[model samples]
Target: MSDTPQDSRRRYSAPVVDGVNKSAGRAMLRAVGFTDDDFRKPQVGIASTWSQVTPCNSHIDELAEVACQGADQAGGKGVIFNTITISDGIANGTEGMKYSLVSREVIADSIETVAACEGFDGLVAIGGCDKNMPGCLMGMARLNRPSVFVYGGTILPGDGHTDIVSVFEAVGAHAKGELSLIEVKQIEETAIPGPGACGGMYTANTMASAIEALGMSLPGSSAQNAVSNDKRADCAAAGAAVLELLAQDIKPSDIMTRAAFENAITLVIALGGSTNAVLHLIAMANTVGVALTLEDFTRLGKGVPVLADLRPSGHYMMSELVAIGGIQPLMKTLLEAGLLHGECLTVTGQTLADNLAGVAPYAAGQDIIRPLDNPIKPESHLRILYGNLAPEGAVAKITGKEGTRFAGTARVFGSEEEAQARILDGTVVAGDVLVIRYEGPRGGPGMREMLSPTSAIMGRGLGNDVALITDGRFSGGSHGFVVGHITPEAFDGGPLALVQDGDPIVIDAVADRIELQVDDQELERRRRAWQQPPPRYRRGVLAKYARTVSSASTGAVTDLPDTD
Candidate 1:
């Protein structure tokens, strides 16, 4: 009395394959290696974000094939599809970086479009870069399918503990005369050794860990090396796990609950993850129909502490952490400390507590993750701040080493390019608060990450001396006294637009406020004078994104209610 094959697994596939009216569809699938036996099986879409455009995702083609093999072995039909990916490392400072965040929307749209069009019942998305991870999750959430996300895995460290950030900082070092052009060239040549995401707890690794904690990815999936046997094994297991998920009828909606998102936030805090986690997590939650907000980060961050000493703020790379058992042990530690929700459902078809029950603790003499009693920071380094300058709130990564307070004169620039020029030429010096505006979601039409300028600031030896506030955002590798995702971005005439050169800007992390020290009357006068700039791109993806994207405070998603 077991369920028949058609009754058991062919919920969506039967309609596409079993009906005579759908002969064309079956015939087309047959050309792609679909047999009569394959027609009876459930279809699992394998979304591959593989390209040679960057080392971050160059190896994903192999991982996608492994996943397809896994599905085929597990009595499911696997169909592979390709999605577009943009390299943040390659696009960091130029106008091309404007497409970086836009690529997330494109990836999500493509995945959802293909899966739905082809009637995929379950999904396995393989992603390597920062946006690819979230884009996959968002697509799966929108589909409400039994989906599994696989991190493309952290890259191996470059020579000399270097990475993409090292290369970026080296450029600044050369500009500052700290290093010769040859030294900069040496770092640029050696920093990216092979295919994988940038080798740090940067956005790629950060989002991977966040997705796992959110229960959308397999345990230990975030910690493996991109080219290793373990990553291949993980990809295969993820494909097979989708069939198990389909059997249990557990979809992303069942896993990406509000409490589950809290677990993600908790882990993100404990690991000292990227500030991009703030933007991407909120966007993922929105896609899943979960009620998450910037304030949630503030609330969850108060109790959680930063334990990982990973770069760009600390001494180690994700590979080193992986060497000591990845984040599994750290997750177990957080679970025991009562910081994580033990009952949250994960992709394993078990509670998060169940997954951690068998996880062994980190080996002795490991300093990668600090003991809870003596944490890297007593609370989360990701501080959500609010004031006149950012009435809708902003995010700051203050590891306490930068001091909790910064009061300086504003060195205003209309764009990141302008700021970078000044910083490279030494026109931007210590105690100057660099205000790079009009680079927000609508303004930049993509909300670009400010890694180059921030790296330059650090490279110029002004890491602790200067501060940067941007309406745009920062890379996971960006550190120092930096604040980003300032709401009501300058394009929308937020307070960031009213500021002029020499204006006093105060960032108080201790109190969680960023104030522009101008009287209301004077601000109103400047506001009256401010004029909204013409759209940067008259037509194309950037223009469309500018037309539809929401505020950064609301995750900068494109599908929100049109308030305009």
Candidate 2:
């Protein structure tokens, strides 16, 4: 008979500890609490994305212990390891933000290195921040190991606002003399109540839910308070879940399939999730050789309603949705609408339908997640626009509340700082498309999130009037009439590099187009004259990244093992 998943010969760690020649390896492990009995069982790696940089991941260390405990209780040997993390919230708008997206690759690489070198049979990656979720999932998929992901959960927003994005918009309002310095200071003081990712349906929460919908995490693992017992239980449960997956020989590739990605896209759009979902999901799918692209987003997202009434585009907070019994109710709704691929396999070794079984419906009168008929938008909030301005394509996140069409004069800035300065000095006026260029993956050396300028525009009460476009990307918290991820980036002489001050630009989200009024000859001449800037860093991690990273259109992933 074929060897069962529980057979000793089937475990990846068997050779590392079972033989006499490997006694030294077992001895070192024994120093740290491993026993001969433990050596006989599975070695499940606990990959924790924990750091003191932000409250988002402050609790993961303890959660890792909880996972270890759960693994030990389940008759497996849990070995804890850590990967690097950078705080996007702490880094936003500054040079520090350059490392935010770059850290995703680092996290994934580190996890794969540790897991493979350590001979772990299975993995449980505990993540809290925005990039960490996708980073962990990418590593898990790359290793093709039996793995499970655990989300640390969302932060509790204090009395002042729902999330850090609120404080960002408040800074804009404060600069425009709308709010006094005292009010802005007050918001900054108490915006984050405790540990977790930035509140709202931002990148962190978005990817967490997307991973769950993609079947990496356990059911109902996406929504919950960071410090709650429920989150603690989920972390522990993830520990046990990976073991179960190993018992069934169910690996990440078994679950991270094309159908699963489409379901994830459906969930992202249905929850009104981050535009980063497009980039990160593409990256994760690429790791597994899945053919997910921007066109897949456009095709799958059609007629998929933005049903969640959550921020940064809508009225409620993530906490409000959590109050309605978490994402299960929402997923259940999608399954009922036939919007989800219910037959896909999850880490549970069961179909998505099996995991979602017995999930209770939302309580009546909860407006957090809207009903299908009365959606936040009749279609997904995200759009991919095409025209002379973005011939390779660009991403526009339309919350339905933002302006449908805008004809504007281009106010060009070569860097984010320059754009922020102009906005703060009140130089940015209505009918201006603030163009920030040369900040794509290779150009910026790390495509930074454009949260500061976008928030300032909203705070200045010019959200509907002013529009911004960049070769870079945005924080999930960013809203308003903004376009980003302009491919064939400015560094590569993209159309964004040709934009001059006073150049007429028109963005029509309703028509799904962005047109530069300049004729082809003018654009061709500007492109010919354009010179690619010298590399910013001659050596170091950032330099390596800029050299290897691809465009944001293809997820900006740098660690493709099979790539040319």
Candidate 3:
């Protein structure tokens, strides 16, 4: 597709390494092990999100090496680069968690900065955690280059089928005297056994599956174990696939179409993925200039069913799903059922249906993925509710197990720590709707996930009884009757900011509404008296994020039109 004749693969690289005028650039690259022959080949930037801050990304360094090898073998000169990854699991409840969503923006910016500066002809971004996955997609879409994303893969379950969620809940269990100190310590020590993303179908797995379904990743790339040979193969294949994509001039814009996004939404709904998918998918779509909104999710959810019985609300983990032949088989089922767009192009240089052509169905009698007719929820478990409480919209994950409707007296808290403390103690009980506000994108300056408090609620045995509504987001691992991503965040004087203790709140998933049971005049009166809190951080990235991040309803993206 490019007119450059100096080695066809060197479309972008030729300008940087071919001419005599570019000797300085070439000289710098030479110091990094670039040979004369390597300079003539296409450059493939492997954006590696390898960090020891979390186990999720700890193994990605080796995966990056595998990808680079594949690129070299495919006749492209591979250049490895690093990006930052913050641990949402470790930062969930503390002030440090405010950097969680902010990290997504930072990751995207860094990847774009590196790729653009290097003038790489293609990219293979490897992400292991929740934020970095979407961040990778966003960066690739920005570059509009021949790119492939590789998931670091899901972690294996620990002893007794426990995970990070088990550890958070164990703390609450210990607080409630349901588990001894030794028992809690045992769970804390064993929940995270080794490297990989969270074991369940949390945000990491959800985003990986969504990206694969969006045609940005290779088939089965979303379903391999972190330490498995399959994952290494996936990384290598992604690297090789980018060369094919470069040859065909198939950029991310060509693959990340509206139809492709619809396929992604369908698969995510069917898989019972995280509500964070709504945020990340919208963000990714926005980056690619695709018009996706919360309403699109509502439209798609009407037909898509929750089939995968895995995750925080379900019975299994991603490892179990991987053992049962991954998501390819399920995709085949969806395609046959007319739920997926068969014509959508993918990184494989083939249509989505073509990729799934030979994918075998899940083995007979596997309960991991329920049949369509006997689906886990019959429709999507993700409900986007709008009411006085959420003037724009709010996301709620209702698996029917948590029931579709909840009405309770408000138990207000200003932050996650407050709510978490109340939940751990005997303060938060049944018939309570925990209103956790001032924790949205701009409000929290990072839109922290409320995994700790929600896990605590479950551990305290009030999951079925209590509900939490927040302007902040929830972790994919946080279930129960919880609503998050309330728009016009509390910091901006959203309705959530006006809520007070003992006020009645009703969340009706069937009606798709989250209402405050108060008179309009009273709400207006309270709004008139409400005062916006001072910025939590006076300087640094958090302060900058607070000043620039958009509302949760708009994907919480920073580069959008006027972060306000």
Judged by whole-model lDDT over C-alpha atoms, candidate 1 comes out at 0.93
Q: What is the lDDT of residue 70 in candidate 2?
A: 89
**What's the C-alpha lDDT at position 114 in model 3?**
91
Q: Per-residue CA lDDT of candidate 3, range 335-384, in tens?
A: 99999999999999999989999988888889999999999988889999
Using all chains and alpha carbons, the TM-scores for the candidates as numbered come to: 0.98, 0.98, 0.98
Screening candidate 2 with a backbone cut-off below 3 angstroms (N, C-alpha, C), the clashing residue pairs are 56-196
lDDT of 2 by residue, 1-564 (tens): 223345552367886776778889888998999876787778899999888988999999999999998887887889999998888887888988889999999999999999889899999999999889888998888899899999999898777564798788888998898899999988888888889888899999999999999999898789888889998898888888877887778999999999999989999999999999999999999989997888888888786999898889887778778877988888888988898989999988999988888898888888888889888888878898888988888988997788688899999998899999899889999889999998899898799999999999999999989999999999999999999999889888888889999999999887889999998898898888888888777798889999999878889999666646
- Residue-level error in angstroms, candidate 3, position 550: 1.1
Q: What TM-score would candidate 2 get against the native?
A: 0.98
Segments in model 3 whose C-alpha atoms lie over 4 Å from true places: 1-8, 562-564
Sort by TM-score, best first: what order? 1, 3, 2
lDDT string for model 1 (301-382, tens) is 8999999999989999999999999998999999899989999898899999999999999888999999999998988899
lDDT ranking of the models: 1, 3, 2
**Candidate 2: where is the Cα deviation over 4 Å?**
1-10, 561-564
For model 3, how big is the CA root-mean-square deviation?
Answer: 1.7
